[model samples]
Target: MSNETTTADGGVRKKGKLGQRIAYACGNLGQAAFYNAMSTYFIVYVTGCLFSGVDKALAAKLIGVITSLVVIIRIAEIFIDPLLGNLIDNTNTKWGRFRPWQFFGGLISAVLLAVIFSGMFGLVNVNTTLFIVLFVITFVVLDVFYSLRDISYWGMIPALSSDSHERSTYTALGSFTGSIGYNGITVVVIPIVSYFTWTLTGAKGEGQAGWTSFGIIVGLLGILTAWTVAFGTKESTNALRAKAQKNGNPLEAFKALFQNDQLLWVALSYLLYAIANVATTGVLLFLFKFVLDNQAAYSMTGVIALVSGLIMAPLYPILNKRIPRRVLYIVGMTSMIVAYILLGLFSTNMTVVFIALVLFYIPGTLIQMTAILSLTDSIEYGQLKNGKRNEAVTLSVRPMLDKIGGALSNGITGFIAVAAGMTGNATAADMTPSNIHTFEICAFYVPLILIVLSLLVFMFKVKIDEKMHAKIVKELEAKLASGEIVDDEAQTAETVEAIDEEAKTLTE
Candidate 1:
């Protein structure tokens, strides 16, 4: 779908260029690569290896405390996401609000990614209390920068194009690249952490130093990709923001968020999906290390995720044309549940496990891609209903839900590890058969349940289908052409001219 803008010359212009799609999609690869490494492996590093060989009791306690902190920090983002969104909305600069934040956020997040993994600044060597403080501080800072980049980055989607097809195309590209960057590391990280050893210290591959070295490489790569996005994609100001700003109620920004029905439903559904998705990824390390007794299988599972996304990404726009997003959501959720059940039944068989994962992730790709597209469309829904576009605040819902879900999943992983005596120097050999089963339950069943619950929220609440979206875009375009949507500054200038003309006539 061409994002048609009614030009001053009464002509329509297309906004989504091929180059812009490639550039914007490239950023996802960088950002996801950096973030995925941390979200999936950071907790494993801390609980599984960082405090290894300490007193079993002390190590367990430390894992508990640090895990708690991770949860708290993520929960805190519920407040932080919106505030950052509001800030992003209010910001004005020559570079554009989104790019400036995207560039700086990506840069800072890249540096912090290395720092977080490096365990530098005395974080790894410090006592439990001090480590928690440092960890929380670093995590929060990284999250803030991440939010700056994420909110601005995805927020730009609505600005990129208003057409549903165009939005989904960009979204699919982003999802495709992001899944690769995000899940692709799962294929390599474990192998690197498990088998590849650095020459400097000859430490084990999964050891602290090895993970730190890995982080540095990933962080630099993220910086490069992020820069690709910053320089490559151009954001158009001719979006919902024009009319939304005219109707913007700064003081009511927070309240306005809840009032947007499309945003609300999409956000709520994403919250559940994110929790399930994050938890499942969190459990992969344990699942590979403990139940499967081979860390290399992580790569295989990661391959499943990556391949499924690859297969589905290109198919999304095609599939979406045929199926309603709601139906797709249901099918995806149901497929995921069935796959998980099959995975649990065939837990010991690697071949079956791989097959089940392949099935699970195909729909998983659909779920992820559509969620992003849905959120992008919600910006128009908000603008149409509220008379103001809160793109940043609205887009912030993803990270907000993501962080919340990640926190829950991470917290659960930590608690499960502590309870099963898997924390602090615990290896696959140390776990009993029952402990392996517990890992499976966390890895598969919990997420299965969450997906089902989210499906409920999606079916009942999210009402903006493709047809409705098309109608919204058409109406908005008509308004723009008819001059109902006016720029605030331009309106002010026109008002000033009218007053001046009247004054001149009276004086004459």
Candidate 2:
């Protein structure tokens, strides 16, 4: 028999196990790997591949166009993500709502990951117009499965735990595991395979053999990672809320989603952070090549340091106990400020740049993990305020921001890099060139400035902390149990905490 039942508020209520949460976080390794590889290295890979076989200027333009197209496709995903979320909400599988979506999304993502760099559609011989057409189609198709899976993956975060501390721990776990493994593999290890293939194929070209092989390897890994997550994830029945039988039209649902305020702020913060992140990640090639003067070490050196920041993520719950989420956001933004300033001012010595990268990413990484946890908190906030659990709707914010940020960043960054006059082989020795100079400025200066500004935005913000969250979750559970309007506001904060702590004891 079907297990889902409707709560008075029309939202699904369920709890997942600790083991499932751990599996879910591990499964997220693929997501992190794909994102890190694509955002940081994809443009560089394409540039190298094209330069080996084609003109340098033309190759730059080709990379720019392809990057811009990927961004465009990403922007389109804002619309697709919510639709995918609703479908998962409505779905019923013996395997559960989320796992099936995860399975299909993984399979599709793996196939396309390899296809994007397959050389099945040779780039060297294709005319500019033809190149644009084929590349756009392939990249857009890649985004489709990507957004679907992305929406489903993050949407499940809240399902893992209702307790504020547990949820923060889960988010931190995902961040920590993903940061170490993803960066380690993508940076330290990826080039080994790429370089090896380059030797084997005797494809003396820049990255034709390397990237094509790289894409295949990353894709196969993604498939395996995704499969593990799908098989292991336990989709507990939503002890509350009935599943929808009718399929949703994507546009109508977006209109409905647009009206959600908690969702709106989460979406906004995500969009801004994404813009900052994409620009930072996208500029690495230019920095190592032109600013650091080491083309070979460009990929790993500064980036590897960001892993230090991930270490701070698991400290979130403890910090949240002492500080509000908004304050934590400010802290993150402040750390970013110091990091960015160091890069902008003292990015000279290898040691200075390495320290700078560590400082910058640590706070940046905190904000990265915090944003989702805060948003998950808001999903509870959203439910209390709006009377609908619509967990998937709130989760859609990640993708919506992703698409907007990716599109704007990708397109704008491409054009910006070109206008700045950055070229393919821009080693530090090449820094005297004007575009390379602009590339350096945009890379360090822009992110630094944005960090200070982001801090300013949260100065007056109100956010729930550990105590406040306990009260909130307790009130929701009491109402769900009693089926009566207990003067929710009549209960003092102390009273609410007492009730919540009591209820949790019962649950345990």
Candidate 3:
């Protein structure tokens, strides 16, 4: 949705343009698809096969251990993702600072994914005293490349366009298209795994061999899909390009987060959302196996994705027009809360569970997209307040929170499973009523609780809205034009003005 306003000289305009909008959409689509793969597939693939090997319970433990290791590798990423982002923020190339990173980042990540998958298959001989070590090393390699690709990928958004609205629109586009890839990958994974495991086999069948092949295919697609954004999008800012020439301290770039309160809130809020999202994705296997009664033949989750995705765009416009973003976002998070609670409470009926999946998708997509748009807006507020533009640093928070939250969620889920007795019975063809309790919590309680908490951070803690951001933008533009420092007069005036406005209210 576009908001119209008159400038200081009374010229009417909307904040962002269409080109930047499209570019943001592509970048997000590419980025989202890449992220979706890790959440939906990686752990499930690992544990499902290992369960057939050694003791199923021990295999579950192994899956938890390895996936947790992958998650831990991601923590090291707190330093790495942003470091890549900072490098992109400070780099200057004829090709532009952000896109170059995207191109190489996507290509490199895809390559490493292949290695990760290849290693997964050959891991039988390797699954010994050195099992954990080899798996950790292999996954970490791909994880590092993912860090490079993800940080460089998202950092492009603020650098590409200065308009808050454009960032949202483009973010929506990226989200929409990327959902295609996201859902597509899951859909394909469902059939592909089923096919390889069921079809490609000797007396031993495919076993581990099948899953490994699946990883290879997933990795190749990730590489190509991510590269499309790097080459397809462009950056609009010139000031940032010039900023690269000064050779300022790299530490100062990340230091922007502590100094900018709006950005800090955005990052913190993102962290909360990331936990809910990762948990939601983490439970896909549970939903498919027990929630759907192990109808491994037909792909119910893939169907959920296709149906939910069809309505995401129109749903966004309807929610945005009727509810303030805050309320719309609340509706989205609350939907997840309700969906998960229901799943935990009474999901014995596959029919009802399937229906709830539909309900869950609309709000989940809405909340995810809205949170992303909010992050872009937060960056604009950061530039408005500080008068120093650092898109990469400012925008890095999304991916930063994503990996951090994901790591935390993985650690928690693994711990939860171990405590709840997921030893090997987690994937039993017939789950007992007691085990169903554990599955319910994983699917519903975890996601619903996290989302409700996220909404609390957003609704009660966040202060800025649209009006406040517009006013800040107007004042910052004027200051930029006149070289008037945002000193006592301007700072006090804006601070007070911020109180009277909307969108991004945390002027602190």
Give lDDT per model, in order: 0.75, 0.63, 0.61
Q: Tens digits of per-residue lDDT for model 2 on 199-297?
A: 867644355666667777777777777777798787554322222233245554565466445455555665666777667766665666666676577
Off by over 4 Å in 3: 1-30, 55-61, 127-131, 202-206, 238-248, 314-323, 412-430, 486-508
Task: List the candidate 2 regions with Cα displacement exceeding 4 Å.
Answer: 1-19, 120-128, 203-206, 238-252, 299-303, 321-323, 481-508
Pick out the ten consecutive residues of candidate 3 with the lowest summed lDDT.
Answer: 238-247
Ranking by lDDT: 1, 2, 3
lDDT at residue 104 of model 2 (Cα atoms):
86
Between prediction 2 and prediction 3, the one with superior lDDT is 2
Top candidate (lDDT): 1
Write model 1 residue lDDT over 1-508, tens digit each, in one string. Answer: 4456764432234566788788898888877887677666778877877777477777778888878888888788668888888888877788777888878888898898888787654466656677667778888899899888888888888777666776787788888898898878888886666554555567655777677777887888788887788888777756445555532444557776876666787888888888888888777777767777787667788888888888888888888888877678889988878888887788777788877877778887788777887887767655555446678888888878877877887787887788776766567789887887787788778888888889998877677766666666666566656776453322244644543343234323
Which window of ten consecutive residues has the lowest lDDT sum in model 2?
A: 238-247
In model 1, what are the clashing residue pairs, if there are any?
244-388, 244-389
- The TM-score measured for candidate 2 stands at 0.84
lDDT of 3 by residue, 216-249 (tens): 6766666665666666656554332233233235
